[model samples]
Target chain A: MAFRASVVRLNRAIVYTQNGDPAQVLRALTYKPLPPPAPETVNIKYLLAPINPSDVNVVQGVYPAKPSLTSLVDGQPDVFVGGNEGLAEVTHVGSGVTDLVKGDWVVMTKAQAGTWSSSRNVGVLDVLKLPRVEGLTEVHGATMTVNPPSAYNMLNDYVALEKDEWVVQNGANSAVGQAVIQIAASRGFKTLNLVRKRSDIDELTRKLKDLGATEVLTYDDLNDRNLTQRIVKEWTGGKGIRLGLNCVSGPDTTSMARLLGQDAYLVSYGAMSKQPLALPTGLFIFKNLTSVGFWQSRWYKQKTRSDKENLFKTLATLIGHGKASPEHEIVTIPAEDSDEVAGQKVREIFAKIAEGQYGKKVLLKIAGSE
Target chain B: MAFRASVVRLNRAIVYTQNGDPAQVLRALTYKPLPPPAPETVNIKYLLAPINPSDVNVVQGVYPAKPSLTSLVDGQPDVFVGGNEGLAEVTHVGSGVTDLVKGDWVVMTKAQAGTWSSSRNVGVLDVLKLPRVEGLTEVHGATMTVNPPSAYNMLNDYVALEKDEWVVQNGANSAVGQAVIQIAASRGFKTLNLVRKRSDIDELTRKLKDLGATEVLTYDDLNDRNLTQRIVKEWTGGKGIRLGLNCVSGPDTTSMARLLGQDAYLVSYGAMSKQPLALPTGLFIFKNLTSVGFWQSRWYKQKTRSDKENLFKTLATLIGHGKASPEHEIVTIPAEDSDEVAGQKVREIFAKIAEGQYGKKVLLKIAGSE
Candidate 1:
């Protein structure tokens, strides 16, 4: 590789002028070169960015956290940049950027910095440098901060799991759910995974097992009391499922609650079902089971810089060893494409995601100029 | 009042051999006087016993804590006692009974000791002596352990409500709800109470206000967004509702949850609606609210003897100062009536209770032969 000149370059960004459906409100804009990073800041060229459910919610104006829109970008006044999670390459460093260098790779530690762009400037404090370990793909680094940490923290934060202890979760095939199984397996904890019934039930079960799930069942299986009893008996030898991760609420939440052991906790993170959580009164009154909500964004806000960097270092090591990695589908956006063409392509993918046409997460790869 | 003979008395006992409807399974039996108090026991003449909702649940075999049905009573074979709360006068004390005397007033501290009888013997450990306060009544002593402690602990245990801080509770006219209002008021804590609509709404509101309620509203008020916002603002003065006491689950719980402040807690102790608790995803995700169950019986089981006595002492002081008292209705059960006649009357009152015929709690006064 030749040494690339540290020169100014035109920036391309995806911006949303108002809160509405992404296809209707989102636009692509070309702007003047981003300013050389401030003394305490570092310039970065985004390598890849993934579309998250929360990111979609932010664009639609339903999420609580929002990016501040101002007349910061030249030519496009009062516009907000689009994405929250992505991987980037350090293109230039400011005078005060001590820890990061031109060749280093980084990912956002905090959210709402607008990563859906070809190039941007961010304070060194906003990004955590990823270790340059072999086999650590840009796809893995792009997606690591949100889903993996959520799974790792949910499993280890509330309850301590001894080897062979059980952890149960609904939405077992979701991105975070897959990460939970693999992480728990690596830690010697067993998982009882629940998923919605699909036509490819056997294939899905096999795939989850390959990812380290100890057992798999559908929502229909949860209703069969005798089957649940038999599974609990054989899987735990009568010990209770100590930690329950609930992302799908409604009757799904109540069914998962029934399988909790004494003093167990069911942490609710996402409500993909858009249904309210229903819990039997006896569960809380007699069994002492607790229902709590978890938001990775909130947890991210509270964590310290060193804490976040340490988590990333650990996750990177896992990815290096192939012990923790999310399944993803990559979509490459060409560097020379017009703003309108790029934005249209992005909107099409968002529409497919809304219709559940894609099972794996979709990542947008920005083909940088060499 | 005449000085009655403190002599051996024929004891009439009410017992149930199996769990079923209180009216169908309960029977009265005239038995020999309970054996003279054992070395560590005291013989007591029952003064008053109140029928509680949990008491009904106990008789119907739906409660978690069940009295062991053994052939303990002389002629009644393998039967469980019919009551759980009462006030009594110490008629006799055994040689080893050091703390209690012949006329001391006491009440059952631990649950499931037969309380619905004319006379009985119990170990001193089973009862906590009521303070000899001038204003203390049999009704207050009979119902101290469950509701008052439940209200006090729920407000104090989960979250700390400082002076002038606000606490909200549904079922504001129920025994526990009324107790919560009085206790919170005595501590300088403000309360926003929610109750069901009734024909006598204003009358019930006035009654709760007399018990120190800051404000009272019907369930309909919860549905009006502007009304809820205005009440929350005025009651809290922008401070959050830190503690929410919920006894009625279902939509009642969801409505209460909506009014909680940031990081607030909703403690569910009873489900009068018999409906499951339903909570919206946003409340948990954004407000950081939590839902937990509270069972006074469970708390009582965990507390030490001094812990129980100290609580009762504090409660007695409150009652003596006219700060705490539960509303009650008293019924006299004549000691000389036939087993058939007395059982018939007991069944009639229970039927009334089942029909929600009375607002005040019913207390049976066994007029033992003098």
Candidate 2:
């Protein structure tokens, strides 16, 4: 902390000149450090930025969100820096910026605001101040802004689920899915978690049950008509599921939709299968089903600053108590690494993530490659 | 009208003992007429009952709304009577019935309440008394209960559509589609209607446009990528459609969903193609699209009697002033025909309906084969 005030640091960022294969397009750029915060702006040095799946899509030009592009990099005309969610330390507060100051921890409120950078000047509104974080880990802090809030909003926004009420979701092994399981479980809500069929089915089932899941079954289990019927008939007493969170879409999503009773809602946040949701119109007609989508970026835009802060406070409390745990793998980038090596490291990590091999979220523990 | 109060006519109903092909399973039963309505009930003779596609489904036992089964039929132990929507003339009102009287006009509020029967006793709450019927046709009186209200509700329930705002719907030639066109037109809203590619598509387009459609295109238009994109970019100037009414589900339904903008709602009332709605998860997540189903039967159950009556009155007035018209084929059954002939006639009409030859709605004009 004392070194930051005494010495100036060069800012290095993983920026892309064009959208395509992440490994081929992404590169590290060394840029001049900030002078001081402009009015209403605060300079933040990103402590940790998680490489999410959607971040890959943003680089591939397939994602809906666009990254903030800048020409400030010393040799680049314009480049988009990767990473959407990050934990940062405020280094210098801009004139008239009272909400944030040096040494304060904050999270990005802006979507794709180029959090992959070491440090940048940003309007105070673009970041939300994290409450005292004595007990929370940096990984929890970095991953907190995206997946947890999404899980919280998906459960609370669509349906008012009562205690012990059941929620069915696919991609149950995904980051957001785990958060949903923990959050719903904490609310006394039961979850029917569906995942892809794997060899370690029993182990995955046990893992989810430990997270307070009432039932854990692979998508293959839904193929048996009798078993599917029995699930609603015996487990829910035919009340059926009212809320379905889907990240994997295809015929299996159709089956998941079938488990929903009349007047139910299916909220889709991702398409892990990259397949369309082939749902029978009868679910929407006969069963009065509704299929909707949820985007964390959209939620952030629509909600008030206080709404987000309150959510952050609540989730931090839960995470502090070890009630909600998000599995993350941290990859460190030392401050003195060469530009090519550091950027290559980021590109390779993203390539592995895009291929789904990184199974858990990967957070970059980076200050800069100075 | 004079004979209704004086004569005690025998009752006859088209009943299905079991579900299967309507041609093979439907039978006409000549049951004893009502012996004065049993407290708060009223005796009504159906003037006309619309043999909807759903009615054919009802006989096939594929429809969602179950037909009311009665065991009082002289020969059958228990039988399900066909027909859902009807306009009946009230006769021999029971002692406790004050809202209805002999010779009054009424429509069934109950879904699949055995309206195919010539005369039967129904609870007062099961029927809504028509305000006045002097200027309305029997077809309008009969068809009004289902499609118009469905069209009205689908437009109003999901989106707050303003005048000149566009609504997109497939099944442009359907009875409900025509109603949607007229009702939307009456409200100063425009419609982009899509229909199947048939030999008479041009003629169908002309007909729909005559009924107040802004644009009528064959589903094949959606297959053209440039045209579909143009519909949103050119016609709407990227304001994109906010409400889409889908009946034909499949890939085409997916294209219709794509036409919708962010925060749009796709209200599906039926699935004529019997195919699933294959939608990309991105539409819901990035675009904030919501796909929901609309069932007129569910609407009947959820809304108050007066809510229905208000809609009925509004539609009836519209029908009275020639603002809206539903095309229907009235097939009459002579009062003295044999039960075998009458039953066979119904089965044949339904077979034709199921085969889609009856492009227009088929209304059964029956006092019964007494």
Candidate 3:
């Protein structure tokens, strides 16, 4: 079986001979064909891929993991294939492969580049079986591989919360926070959500509440020290909060730490503010507080094969039962378009995400079927 | 059998009349007597009491728990009693008390005042049997009730550290940190100790190392970013740290958080700096870090009776085995001296402590030993 792939012939990716900023950094161009899948590799017909903030970071050379430069296409010296993971259909299985058949939906389970292309070959182990669910579409599966799992593992691994216990998280409107709200709610736990105050905060709050948030609050609510204290006291019945999730660190992180009960856990995952976290020592000494960091990539890599299998099974069950659904915006790009055009679209969408303009994930449609 | 006690009568505690503080607050006068112990109370012959920071906070009307005002004394008003808990010999058991016997060494296991006096009547539940360990003095026993237990619980409760695992803590020169160093070492765990750069830091580091510190360093060492990273890499074998104990919050907390591995726990228990904790959110999201607060008093209050008893037994055994000892400075106050003289001595010692001239705990020795 043969399919055309927008392979990186050289290191050059999304290049323009005429250079400027974003317009020049990501130059769309055509690339030469790549070799077929080798033994133990499966050629995937890329269906859709999500334009994530980390993807933008990767292009900017700030991401922790960089794609290997050796895999660049022959002619494109400055360009490299960039997408981390995406949903696809099995086009051709290598001689050694037995698990996946043609037309089976799969997603990259590990760090794999060239996901922005129409087709790419990846190791069998790097691909996860995407069980077909009635309501979940290809776009949903494309976007489901990262943020949802991050939220799921963080809430489940840190603290074994009771049904009535509360989980307070900043960035409540983000995809991960939203997933957390839903997953926590489904597990019989309550969520106290914190998001930036917008003109449509009430509507946003309503949306989140409908998604299983017990309480939706703005950063303004957390900033007013007295009101924050009062709200925390009332909500926690003076027992104080048990778990505080923070992505927006700064004064807000310190405030979250203060509002927690004795021995409460504060888990931080992102620094949207790019500011250092300032927490009071009293929170540590007098409160017996524990602060820890979480990285999904590292956590997933560290998990035993059995644990990973169990997690995937659990996630599959949730998706199959409609308890967990991806909230995504799908943008279909034609397979005939140059690789540069597709890269530009992903970059534009990611820029909006970086600016906090986009609320939902942006999925790039690659396979014509999707 | 009634024994003479230099009790601070209600409404007539010694007070500082001026903001100049020490000299002004030294006056002590007589008032009416306190009521006898209530039912289920045990009258204790106060053997020794240790002056603690909380006691000073209380005298300044800054402590959280405020004592009630009463006119049972000679018409004086607004008087406050000092002392939290102390080692006492059971002198008289009230009607409902069955666990305590006369001549047994006991310590107040709960919040109480009036330990400065020769005797105090407290609830039987609020007192614990102090096992007779050879060479354990009453002064040492009084000091043992808080810091040692706090260190023990903080280290044991937060991380399930293995024998070869390392525990890092700041304020290594502090009583609690020192205790942690010893306890962790005795339990076959290594300690990466961080202390302020004092004039006697070398001596202090040596002493701490003798007590169980694997490596003793100063904040200056942590200030060099590259050096800190290298040290962390070497200490953890590039795997990352497991537990970080912080009492000094602020920018220091951020450093501590950064040094931790994924899913590592940072426990805070004290704030000598009186500064808020500032940390980056990357530690939370990317590192899977957890920050939690710890309060020994609150923890003690919440434990079951049997658990409390077991802790005491374990602590006593540790002390008996010479694994732990309270460093103290005993200051004897004659019972025959006027209340004013006794008050002056306390004020002088407290002044020295405030001035940072004292290296060990101040133990008040009340005259009239059994």
Over the stretch A1-370, how does candidate 1's per-residue lDDT look in tens digits? 2225564455677788889988677877766666667898988888889988888999999898898884646565689888899999888799967899997999997678788887888889889899978888888889988888888889888898899898999999999898899889889999999999989999999999989999998988899999878766877787668799989998977888878877788888889899999988787887777778888888888888888888888888876676556667888877687888878888888888888898778887755444
Better of 1 and 2 by TM-score: 2
Q: Where is model 3 chain A poorest over a 10-residue stretch in terms of lDDT?
A: A10-19
The C-alpha TM-scores of every prediction are 0.93, 0.95, 0.79
Candidate 2 has a TM-score of 0.95
Ranking by TM-score: 2, 1, 3
lDDT of 3 at B86: 78
Give the candidates in order of lDDT, highest first. Answer: 2, 1, 3
Q: Model 1 in CAPRI terms: which quality?
A: medium
CA error at residue A166 for candidate 3, angstroms: 5.1
Task: Compute the lDDT for candidate 3.
Answer: 0.71
Error of 1 at B36 (Å): 4.5
Candidate 2 or 1, higher DockQ: 2
- lDDT, each prediction: 0.83, 0.85, 0.71
Model 3 / residue A58 / CA error / Å: 3.4
lDDT of 2 by residue, A1-370 (tens): 5335556688888888789989789888778878788899998888889988788789899888897668775565988888899999898888999888688889999999888878888899999888765578777888888898898899999898898889999999888988898889888999999998989999999888888788899899999999989988887789898999999998888888878987899999988888998899889888989899999999999989899889999988766665555677888877787888888898788778767787677888666533
Two-way lDDT contest, 1 vs 2, winner: 2
